[model samples]
Target: MASFLGDHELVKTLLSSGALPNIQNYEGNSPVFASANFSNNKILKLLLDNGGDPNLLLTQEYVYNSPLMIAAINENIEGVRLLLEAGADCNYRNQLGNSARKIGEASLNLELKALLMACDNPT
Candidate 1:
């Protein structure tokens, strides 16, 4: 809930106490994945730095949204960048066969599309 609330201090406190950053609730929404939809990247960064898996999926029925997808769909560019830098799978598609790259393209976010493209052709 700290992540959803964007409470950075509380999130850090919990992580410091050995809370699993990847632990998802019954909704299949982990702190890491849920943070992607937030307006800020602070919680996402903290979680990622504390061993949160950027590629963790929201396992809701007929849905599979990775942190990258959540970020992309919500237009959280920084969150998307953080997830990408953390080695998120750009090719991963949800149940609807939608990918972050596709979301970027569909949403007309050039920078997002560029980022995904860059990952596809790393130096």
Candidate 2:
């Protein structure tokens, strides 16, 4: 759970020592999910740089949310931008049949909503 605590340096060191970024907790939440949920931009960036897959779906608890969805729901504009720039699927649908765009809209976060719209029409 150190990674979940937003210790960017420690998390990076652990990852460098071969700590699997894909490892999940008891509830099956990945590091990426934790970082997104907590709005930890530093941890998120470190994880992304270290091969954390933003597109990885939560298969256990909270299956209705994705890393992108979580970021959007949390109004994490930078996190959402990072994930999108990292090639996360902007149109991914979760168990609730909602995409990141929908989550952003539902969040009522102007910045996140704008980011999602930009993602939806990149160019």
Cα-based lDDT for every prediction: 0.85, 0.83
Each candidate's TM vs. the true structure? Answer: 0.92, 0.89
Model 1 accuracy (lDDT, Cα): 0.85
lDDT tens per residue, model 1, 30-104: 899878887559888889998999889999885888889888888888988899888898888888988887787
For candidate 2, the 10 contiguous residues with the lowest summed lDDT are 114-123
Error of 2 at 52 (Å): 0.3
The numbered model that scores best in lDDT is: 1
Clashes by residue pair, model 1: none
Report lDDT (Cα) of residue 99, candidate 1.
83
Supply the TM-score for candidate 2.
0.89
